[model samples]
Target: MGSEKPSLLKGTVDAVKACPREIFNFWLFFCTAVWSFSGVAKGFDEGNIASIVVMKSFKTRFVLDHETDDQYANTKGWIVAMATAGAVFGCLACVNLVQRLGRKNTLLVFTLVYIAGIFGQTFSSGSLSGLYASRFIAGLGIGTTTVIPSIYLTEIAPRSIRGLITLQYACCQQLGVVFGFFFNYGITKHNAGTQLQWQLPTALQLIPAVIWGVGLLFTPESPRYLLSKNKRTEALKVLCDLRNLPEDHPYIQEEFAGIEWQLNAEIEAVSGASVWDLTKETFTVTENRRRFVLMFLCHMFGQWSGANAITQYSPTIFGYLGIAGEESRFLATGLYGIVKFVSVLIFSIFIIDFIGRRRSLITGICLQIVTLTYVGAYLGVTNKMSTADIEASSSATAASKASIVAIFLHAVAWSIGWFSIPYLVSAEVFPIRIRSLNVSILMAFHWAFYFGCSRAMPSLLAATHRFGAFAFFASICTCSLIYVFFALPETAGRSLESMDRLFERPWYTVRQVAYPTAADLADGGLGDVERKITDEDLNKVTEVRIESQTSKNH
Candidate 1:
């Protein structure tokens, strides 16, 4: 087990098999799923926006006709991308909320902003001003939606199944996609020419926000967060409840010890540092800077991959590929959403931990490269895809059918590769001391690029004739491929505390090899099999670190 990059899932898989019933239980799953529910509204908004924009009621209300095609694209881009622009602000605001209010409370308070934003938008009949303001307001609430949930899950999760739990946040986002696409299609189909067609879909976001708020009332504060506040007894009780283990049990003691070690490591870094000092440590420290760069490229390249273009403008993209009717476009978009949801669910549950993080990303990226290239070449050879209603062919041509398949394939590749990988990787890889600041900064970039992609998608397609845009996305995917292969270390089965060791090796070769490649040792301290530390050693650290901090204060 102490050999080369040991089979990625062996640590988790063995743990699951050995204690399937005892370790993984209903309580743990329940708490994780409730927070994951927050993603539904985000997904619905993202998927629903593009579909709703093409609705007859929406077009009528917005008076979408413009003097030029470029004018029309710009207007639509602003409408869809505005929420993300607000999201950038939300990310900036989240650190203060999470720091002062705690993770659960921050989410609870923001649900109202999200709900208020949705309420304002649903009722915005003919006012472009109102619609834009609503989108931005909702964006404020939505920004915290993803960042906090992933942080909470990773913090509370048992080491063995942490990846599975954290990825659930992404899984639920797809579930939202399913609801968003299908709901828009259902409403548009039933309502037809009525204003309810757009209003109902727009208002559907409130349901998830309400559910997440109520659930937050019952959810526990992150045990790690509690430890950070020096609530030792409270932190232990929370850990016991979360792990479903006795307070003094070896597993519980070691798990608590690992967190203390990380906390101590954090204290050692700044040692009574203030906010400004912490911010400086974020940049001045080599590891922190390296993680920051990884985050920048993680999102920037991801947005350029063109998958988001497909997600935000699938109806438009399909229409360009020669799909001919409003009904058909909506149907195709709805189905595309389903494919992404199913792919994420299957892979997160069955495959992600098994293949390891880097491999899953690599496999998905390869699929994206192949599919994007084919779609680009097909559009080039045909030179005929359009957003306008072209006459429906008597029968689907082979080339068009293949392009449709290629687009769906592209969605699948996106679902598996870039969809959740960036968030999951970002959530698990950083030290907890600066995790919130880093995550906020990372997601600010996430939404910033998201805003850029959504805002530019229409114009990019319009300017590039759809074909060149696809080619450009393929090129970006190629760069992400190289980055993942060279930069990201495998994170599967590692405890959060041990992530530092993964980056301890030189930057250039991080992806080439992992430290403590042995699966058992990968847990850093919690490894049940061949663990290097004893239960007493864990208890000793727990006691000594607290006393050391106390004595220093005196």
Candidate 2:
């Protein structure tokens, strides 16, 4: 194995070079990066609120009369969770809107809605009712923007680099988190208890929304959406533009043909199928059902992995560890955001495609399980210690430092596994016909669980303290590890059109599944290998195609 490592690395490098570099042209890069602003908006909302809640001014302005600590904690959780609650409705509403309005238009409309919500949030500091209403509206925008970008990026990206490109969403989200944290930290450190400290951060959310919305106007509509609507000429044109290739390029023709064929197959399958029938088939069809379960479970596991709890309540967690002082808490929170940002950035660039989806998720989850267990145990023991003893004992200080290290490590692990895979897998697994609807359904569950976890974190910490909450999350990670090991298939480097065959087999199958060639489908040879094809079959077809093309040139 050690001797073969260099050969394998060389082969991988050769394969990458064989692909066209034109795919990374300026226009494509611009569009892909701009689409990430939606994620930034989401990250900003999540991170900004967490920091704002810890602000003295925010609490002074918003906390109720004669509110106890528990009540205050609940109020903080609710305020932080309101955006997620709004996101649920937005996800559900976008199911049909995406199909009708198309990806670009849907994102544009919702971004405006998000900006509107931001204005409300900025100005409504005087009234809690207005604040809640504005957040829910913004949540609606977030839901729509979040789901559409994944779909759009998946459709636009070339299959070879799809995983890496799609990961832009996660990277941008972390970027937003970092910005939010530092923005809040700066305001808190300088502005102190002034309303502008919180208000300025709230207002800053508008920048990404406007940038994404305006950028959408310049970017073309999704070719997949165009094809789905039977705009063949427009789809072809957009494909050419996106690839920076001509209409007659063989690669372009092959890709277009593949998409058309897959769309036709789906149309044939769902010819007379009603909404109820489609939903029923989604669960009853073995392949569809399996994919749905995996995607849903992935989302659930990612959210329940304690990422949001740590992010949304980092200050509180620091406090629980006996790290007192507002400046210290904010500094810790800022460091947490920075670590997450850097970790996610590194994973997206290096590990995502290299390790494949299954291994990355399992490895990350296992690491999390160990970290959570250690943190939970340490916190539990410390909770039992008297304040005087804790202050004087060197062991307590050492344990506190260890807990901080554990939390940072947990962030790194979560970044590698749960942060982006759920979205990437969901975008790739579902058939194009039902992609929007299926993804929306799963996203709703994501937001719902996100809301639950965020809302419950404060109360959970109040009722169970540090140990109970961390242990509970650790148990969830354990279950996630088992499920991933037994169920989730590797999807890295697979074509979107080939996912149906990929999920049809049992989990134990180790051989690569071959997708049928264009000629095979045209000659009605698809009948022979409609179920599954092996790697050898694909190589044979490729060799024949190369030979025929060479012969024609001669």
Candidate 3:
């Protein structure tokens, strides 16, 4: 029996050693998807609200029937924009709670909070104020959920497929959006004038939150977080389990050492630093500041890409495009949601790592610019023709069809590049010590920008008309393309621990830096990078200390 046990153990080890990279990566991806369910909850709200806003039952319940068209539009914008405002507060609040409670626990707490918000919305009646408050509460949960999952996924994912794994956040979010749209469509079709039309769709938000909270019990806490808390033995064991390797394995050893080295360097630099001091260092350090700027711009431009304007007001946009009838508009919106979901899935799974980050972003933005501009021109001509009393002309119908096609094309292009890249890049850009803080701040800015766009879009449309509104969005896309071309680095396959070296250069003069191969990782290639980063960080700490002492003496 003893002899047989030894032989079995040896065979199992050999089999693990011979396992293919693709199989291993797929397992990791599966694990990532389980944690990314929080995104689905947020996406559900995003898609559901947009659809609900156009429902006759929703407007009637809110007493929008007594309001003018302008008042109705403004009220609708406020309802949709309130969630983003809540998200900004949630993200800012998470900066402290995530670090204190740890990522997994914090997520659980937020999930409960989200459930409360959903209950409020599901049962809301009589007053729009109650609905607004409920949406804001949901937004808080979404904000924390959005930031935490990306951080967890980034920390756990293998370097070779980190981008692909992180992009799942976007994929799951779009999936949630698809579910929301279809759920609303079905409810609207059957329960059009009943309160159930909006109430049922609102209630569906609980499903993803419940699933995510239950799954959190089984999921492991992040190994990197363990290391940060000085639990080295626990960190190592978790790393081994995650990688499906033994403690003595070369990859396991290198990754653990890299984490320890980076953590040590951060401690040395900010040994006695307070939260305020770390915040200062985030801006004062050249590399950190550069990354901050890049992340912020990526997120800011992503919101301004006109996606919210189209997505949040899809029924309205379709109405403007001459698509008649409520049922047709809702069906079109559902189809639009599906196209977005599929396009993002395809790009995240098949093309993200293949094309590299910088090129993909630029190319995607360029396509957005073209599509938006074409849609604008068509709308401009059609609007002028309508004013001239040629309402049923063939050219008007043809232009309307072309504009709809352009909108679908825009979704495809946005999904491939702009939709997910900003979040992926933000998650990958920061160091372990300040990652939570940095990402929280960045996402807060993101939600703030989202709120701005969502709030102002209705007004912008009112002022600019359909054609001018698209032109404005096209102009933003153009600016975004130029900024990405010059500022964003290629971060597709790089190790998270290597971010210091990755951003060491000036932002303008960039080159493609490939990730270390298996052989390179095993042979201590990353060790050399870690050492350089350590030396530089320590030197900066020394210089700062000396300057501080001198000033004190003076």
Per-residue CA lDDT of model 3 for 19-119, tens digit only, reads 53433654465568778877898678878888888777888888888887777778888998988899899888888887788888898888888899899
Q: Local distance difference test, per candidate?
A: 0.78, 0.79, 0.77
Clashing pairs in 3: none
TM-score, structure 1 vs. true: 0.85
Candidate 1 has its poorest 10 consecutive residues by lDDT at: 525-534
lDDT of 1 at 359: 80
Which ranges in model 3 have alpha carbons more than 4 Å from their true place? 1-31, 159-161, 232-258, 282-291, 384-391, 427-436, 486-554
- Ten residues in sequence with the least summed lDDT for candidate 2: 520-529
| TM-score, cand. 3 vs. native | 0.82
RMSD value for candidate 1: 4.5
* lDDT (tens digit, per residue) of candidate 1 on 187-261: 777887788888898888788888878888888999889999999899999888877887878888888987877
TM-scores across all candidates? 0.85, 0.84, 0.82
RMSD to the hidden true structure, all candidates: 4.5, 6.7, 8.5
Cα deviation at 447, candidate 1, in Å, is 1.4
